[model samples]
Target: MKSIYILTLLSFFVIVINLSSCDQSIDNLYTEKSRIQFKYFKEDTVTQGQATVYRRTYFDRTTLSFGMSDDEVQEDTAKIVVEFLGDVSNKDRTYRVRINPDSTTAKEGVHYKPFSSTQTFRAGRRKDTLSIVVLRKDLGTSFINPVDYRLTLDMEATEDFNLGMKDGLYTHLYMNNYLVKPKWWDGVGSLMFYHPKKWKILISFNEKWANKEKEPFNFNNGGREYFEALRNYLEREPTFDDETGARIYIDRLVEQNN
Candidate 1:
């Protein structure tokens, strides 16, 4: 009777261990499958004038199989979003794009073909992406460029059950630099240059912080004092030629520095 009891206890413990192991495996699989990333690249040469080109790429994949069958298949997709932030009124504001899939590529018993899209700008905030959806097999490209625009992308697995994992696997590509025309002196002086409407400038007089930092720092007191000083100076100053005005501006900066 004791032997029978011992055998029953051993069986129960083995069952519990196996169940725990399966649970852990499922958790790992979920973590591995849900992720999204974006990459940006610049394509421009110094000799090619001031034109700039930006590109973004996105990627995702998944596999599915029936528990009772040997048949299994995989699905993979890629999306690219490009954002253009600059003085939209001064630039050509158009884009050219191309997309092609490798027919010879296979992942986990699944094959894929590429599709692409390209177009010209119309009117908007310029936030859109080239989305390629591959099911059994479909391929194409598009060209998209519209005036005043930005770009962003959304990605997902084709399987319905994987829909919940969409957020974990989506990313947005970012461009850190803006294409601007060379700064030119206005006829009336006062440093005239067009910047993107979204850009902001913060002027400050904190020499200690400015000298120690490599990047532009925000005005410590909300820039109100800096603006006020400039307003007072202009109100008290006389009209002068462009060059003279510039000289006076430099002199004022030197005085502030001292």
Candidate 2:
């Protein structure tokens, strides 16, 4: 009788151990399945006359925590591409994107693409946040613009996944501030009307500078000299026609150097 009791106890312990192992395996599978989550954020509403800015940022829990290679992370990232378009109704609206391929590179890849969605403008009020998602394989080789009205998404995968499209993700990302111009040619002949507010122009004047051939033309010292020369030429000969103006500027620089 005691032997039978001991055998029964051993069987119960074995069963518990097997169940625990199975549970652990299941938990690991779940962790691997939903390895990453991408989220986007933007303003909810904007006044008709004012410009609306949208910002997007992404963070991955599994990718951040695990020491995964970039290729691996990219494999998971290819599932979706989120775009932000500024004005919905305007036909001239453009999209822009700055991509940092790796953590080490300071120079970001910039791209501008036309928005492809049909514009649908509301009469009196405007919805603040416009969001869309595309499958990774469908994103193709096109550069994604963060600000654009029409979004083109191609989702080939039949699997359904919940994506978090919230305004909080963009809270910390950098947004390009742009002015909304009523017309494209508002008497100012294709101007730099919409540029980042925080951009600073750096000039370099070193004749022997070797870094110009490399990525991110380093504007450390003496760079302002280049800008100064260009500014002086422009101010002195503001009315010079395009061909003559370029020639004069070049001649002046040659004379100055000689």
Candidate 3:
């Protein structure tokens, strides 16, 4: 009978220990740390030599090329979206971005404006954008080649939040001021060379394109006429090529495809 009583007490203590352990596991499961990451990615449709497939490609790096702008464009803004990965709160939260000088070639005040010491994530918001003002004026000879300036940004932990994913902890942005090729350059037919002086003149032909930012790069004119008209006009009234010292009106038809 005494042995039986001892076994009963021991079993009761064992059950209590298991229940306490289970409660701790439950508490740990409910607790989660807040996290934030950059929500930037590129998507592409692959249909060549295979089935049609849609894929999302995430990038921790991208180039901030300013080649498409007209001569008057001095400063451009880059919008980087940061995403919150936790439940929303009723109070605002702040985050920090540190620069890695070893990997950064762009000067803070010259190539790009410095980021604020802290950026705010408003209450009830799940996403916020970080604006980086990239300065292009007075670049001097630094922009003679492509990708002359690069800036690396890193995420830092703070009282309000913790770093999210390992892969999204940082990003790199490269900058250049050269009048590099635009995306729709091929749609210009086969007669133009992309010269800084010449591109400014070509874009002027369209009144709707006065605001280069709103300019619809598409060559469509409701089946009426558009890029071909620009070609015809240039062919008839050939401007002396100040860039090459040869009139492109005649030379382009035989020599250049900008």
Clashes of each: 27, 12, 2
Model 3 per-residue lDDT tens digits across residues 150-197: 788888877887888777778887777665555555454543555443
Backbone clashes counted, model 1 = 27
Better of 1 and 3 by TM-score: 3
Best model number under TM-score: 3
Error of 2 at 145 (Å): 22
* Candidate 1 off by > 4 Å: 1-11, 18-20, 23-148, 154-164, 168-224, 233-258
* Candidate 1 TM-score, true structure as reference: 0.25
TM-score of 3: 0.64
lDDT of 1 by residue, 44-119 (tens): 3343357654544334322211111212322334345534432233222344332212322222122233343333
Tens digit per residue, CA lDDT, model 2, 1-258: 999999999999999999999999966753421111223332454455577655443342111111112223322221222332222333322222222233211112221222323322232222322232212222222112323222222211112122223431222122121222223212322122221110111112342421223323224633345545544644564323222222233223222221
Decreasing TM-score order of the candidates: 3, 1, 2
Q: Which residue runs does candidate 2 get wrong by more than 4 Å?
A: 1-159, 163-222, 239-258
